[model samples]
Target: MVVALVGNPNTGKSTLFNALCGARARTGNFPGVTVEKKVGRLKLPTLGPSRSGGGGAAEVIDLPGTYSLSPRSADEMVSVDVLLGDAYGTPRPDAVVCVVDASNLHRNLYLVSQVLELGLPVVVALNMGDVARARGTTIDAGVLSEKLGVPVIPTEAHRRRGLEELKTAIVAAASGPALQPVRSLPDAVVAEANALEGWLSEHGCPDVPAYLRERMVLDVGGQVVERYRTRCTGDLPAHLGEVRSRLAEAGCRVPAVEAAGRYAWAREVLDGAVETTPEPAATGSDRLDRILTHRVWGLLAFAALMFAVFQAIFSWAGPFMDAIGEGQGWLSGLVQSAMPPGAFRSLIIDGVIAGVGGVLVFLPQIVILFLAIAILEDCGYMARAAFLMDRLMSRLGLSGKSFVPLMSSFACAVPGVMATRVIENRRDRMVTILVAPLMSCSARLPVYLLLIGAFVPATAYLGGWVTLQGLVLFAMTSLGAVVAIPVAWLLRKTWFKGETPPFVMELPPYRWPSPRNVALRVYDRGKAFVTRAGTLIFAASVLIWAAGYFPGDHTELHAVQAKMENPQVAADMSAEAWDALEERRRKLSADLIADSALGRTGRFIEPAVKPLGWDWKIGVGALASFPAREVIIATLGTIYSLGGDVDETDDGLRDAMRRSEWPDGDPVYTLPVALSVMVFFALCAQCAATLMVIKRETNSWRWPIFTFVYMTGLAYVAALLTYQIGSRLF
Candidate 1:
């Protein structure tokens, strides 16, 4: 049986899902970690075979956190359709768990009431009840259960409290009845809901009542009206008939009026069950909202927070990163000493460790980045970040939800693209998808750091506290995001013209994030990263190694071996110069890579790209980074006198790039080229793997093709502009 865990974005639904399933959880960060859907399996330790339902092995899918049933965005609509059993390939949930932030019951119940209309069995886990009581809010759990006609369990999922009780509730709902009795709205409200159903008849069989009562009320909770309409190919005929009837009766679509009634009915049901005493007429959220939502300070705080994230990536990961480097270096030496000098030894040292280790070295940065993101996200500041940008976003005709996804694009476009699922309007989702790739992703990190660390002087810019290099990094990312804003605005006025979805979202109360919860997240995301290192990364490394390996016989250091095997060279060199000879061997090893197939391919692309000012080496670097962008550094280092440098990854490449040259007596890769490269990456569709995944998620080649073509075109134009303009000025 499929048990769906549905709740508002931060209501601890994921934590609870983890608790129930333990390690059985499957994580994809799908559509790229932004529209992450976690599906986990659970087996009851001991179940009465005769009595257990669905054969006792259960799979629970933790859908994207959605606040309501309205299909406002693609992902949000996924929740609605899944609950309605209308989302293609998704089974109707045998039972659903509606997780609510008990402390924020008033708003939480707003979703709860919506779910009740779905006519399905549900159990409400009054999550964060511990926080609720601590905040002097008393929740009458038994009363709420009786009023809503469902099981209620108080849980602190992060602390693992009340989990058993929650499971019991879930099982009871599953085994007792296939469908639970729905809480009927007041006669007038029900009549109005029916009237909505009548009005929506032109919309189809899965009418407004089914969506309102099933997913919104009984399953997911919260009345989120998604503006993007979805009707299956098979259902379009019904929709056509429905739309015909609706147009036949004009002035009948009353989304505003129906919304008021839903809220009114919700208020009545929750009136006395949950009590919140006013706090001397001022709340902490309110007080903080004053400054945090202020037009000026809010922006400054955002700036400061963003600075911290980048600071952690470049600065905080240094010592540990260095340590990791030294350890990998030592390991390589040991392997070389132990293994006989042959292709096997080189494969282990250069191909496997160098390539794999190159990618692994960046794990620390990923961890640091996601940790900071989680902290800001959990602390509720992220919502405020969205709030602060509301005015600016509205001018661009965007919902506030569009902001974080765009921000996340800096780390990776895949996640950023997926995150746009939170936006309910198809046009908004589409436009956001189109612009997300423009943000400088984490793949651009290695390239940016390589250049910025070398060329930009590390002296204080405004003061000694801020290095010019750090400021430069921040400015590049900020500029990338800034460029996307005008692009989004332009798209709205042009090809994406339709009503942008209305932005109506509840801001949950701010609480100190649970460390236990944060710990779980750190571990979960870390585990996911490790798995990638082993799987996709492992495969990509092998493929790249093969590309660099073939077309040469006796691949045992072809350049180094040729010299050593030469009798004249052997006679000239004495035992005293063996160490020098070995160093020469390393340089020779590096030279062979330049002549290899991978190297030749770089030369092939260089001519085409040279007008954009990149050399053959840059072409090789770009080629190696298809799987992931950070691998470019390793590839570049390997191409320039650092044999097997992809494995023996080093920061020296940045310095190397500084001293490298072109044939014309000019610097091959100067500061402007570096900046242009950064801009190109910020706008370009560089990650082939991300493009492939986008194809899988959208289930069409069309969107991915559009994404790749438009983004690459934009990247080229932007790079051309920057270079042509910057060259004249500088």
Candidate 2:
């Protein structure tokens, strides 16, 4: 048997799903949309002859949280299609579980009422009953069940209360007959819907469900009508207009009528079944909100909290990242010991191990970021944060919901792009996704640090409170965000042009975040990055390795490395002779890289980059780092014959960069050139993993490709301007 779980946002629906499914849930995207599909297997008590004494197995699909079945976009239509068994590759649900917040019963019942009209056997999980009680809202579950003709199970999902009863109800409902459709609509509306259903069946869309026919009559310019119009033969819009006209004549106007009828039915059912006491002037949450949501204090609190989160992501994850890097090195060393000096050994070490390590190095930051977001979100502070930021975001043609995602991009754009799912408006979500990569992530830090430390003088000002190097670092760090404002405005004005929708979100009462749910969220996000984005990063890493390794003979280089590794050969030589051999090896390795495919491409683009004060070596570093911004440090290290293991701060590598020059003996390391490099990396979309995540989130390669092209172009123009202007002044 298959069961579908549906509910409104922040109603403990996901909590319930996690409680029931535990670690068994698997998350994936829907057939053609980015909306997540989570399915898990459940073992139910046997009550039928087929099961005998054994427990029965069922598959439970947790649908996206929605306030209503009236979908406005293709993504929103997915939920309705899945419920109606019309979604491709999804089976018809044997039963539906409508999870509702008991404290907000009246408002939540709007969705429940819609579900009741689906003509499917449903079990209502009245979740958050404890919260309802705390709010002085008492609901008579038995009476509510009798009124709706469905079993209502009161559940506190976080506390694991009432889950067994909910499961039993689901099994019983799935085996039972489908319930009669709720009579929420007026007779005229129902009659018109039935007539329209017959008309659609005759007009080529024979499989349109009865519930959908009612929706077509109720939802004005909704997804249902638009979807069916493409399939129906002729004049479907005219037929719909005629039916709506007759219904209006009978005083049953669409859209509004549906809401009125559903609310009326809900009120009638709950007339004597619910009791509420509202006497408190300010509850605990309200009292805290006074300061937390204050214009001044709230912003301060949000800033401090974000600072902590940023620190955690930047500083806390360092040890883990280093450990992963060390492990990669150790593994490479072990492979060198176990294998011969050849192309295969280099492939295993450089292509495979290095690529996989690059991907894993990001896991720590991703985990910490998702952990912080999940905790903040589950505890209810996220809504207030959005509410506070709405005013500012509105000016950019976005709601406050875009703030968190953009802020998150400072840590990494992968999770930041994923976080846009919270924004319901499609235009706003797309805008957020497009602008997210502009936030300078941690990966860009190495590039900035290397340039500032190398070129920017340590001149002090303001009694040494600020130094030129410090100022340069700060400017580079903030450069992307400063540039994003105009980019966002331009994007909104052109591609995603639309009126910014008013931000309306319910601030759920503050409570402790459930650990189980937080862990699940972190695990799911981490798993997704490693499994989906990791594969692409790994493949790109291998391709880049092959590019730099090929089109040049490495036999002599391998022989030099083999001789250096032989202790017997090294012991017989004097220190001077050993030093000369090492130099020879370094020179040989450098020559091989310079003659490789990537090197040739770098030279090919040197002319284009010359205006930005960069040579072919700098161009090569920029191109090599496309897989990740920080890879430029290692790439530069290799280009200078200092080995790929050197970091941005390595003295030898820094000195080599200082000593680098053009054919005319002019130094390559200059203030303007360093600034140009930093500016380019700051504005560029250089991370392949982030691009992959964007592709996955948008469900299209077009956006990622567009992002890469636009950002690279923007980077080049900005870099050229920075160098040209700075050179003349300095």
* Candidate with best TM-score: 2
CA RMSD of all predictions:
6.3, 2.3
Residue-level lDDT tens digits of model 2 in 249-306: 8888777898898889889989889998857345788899999999999999999998
Worst 10 residues of 2 by lDDT: 46-55
Give residue 7's error in model 2 in angstroms: 0.4
Clashes per model (N, Cα, C within 3 A): 24, 0
Q: How many collisions between residues are there in candidate 1?
A: 24
For residue 91, model 2's alpha carbon misses the true position, in angstroms, by 0.6
Model 2: residue 207 alpha-carbon error in angstroms: 3.6
lDDT of 2: 0.88
- Residue-level lDDT for 251 in candidate 1: 35
TM-score of each: 0.75, 0.95
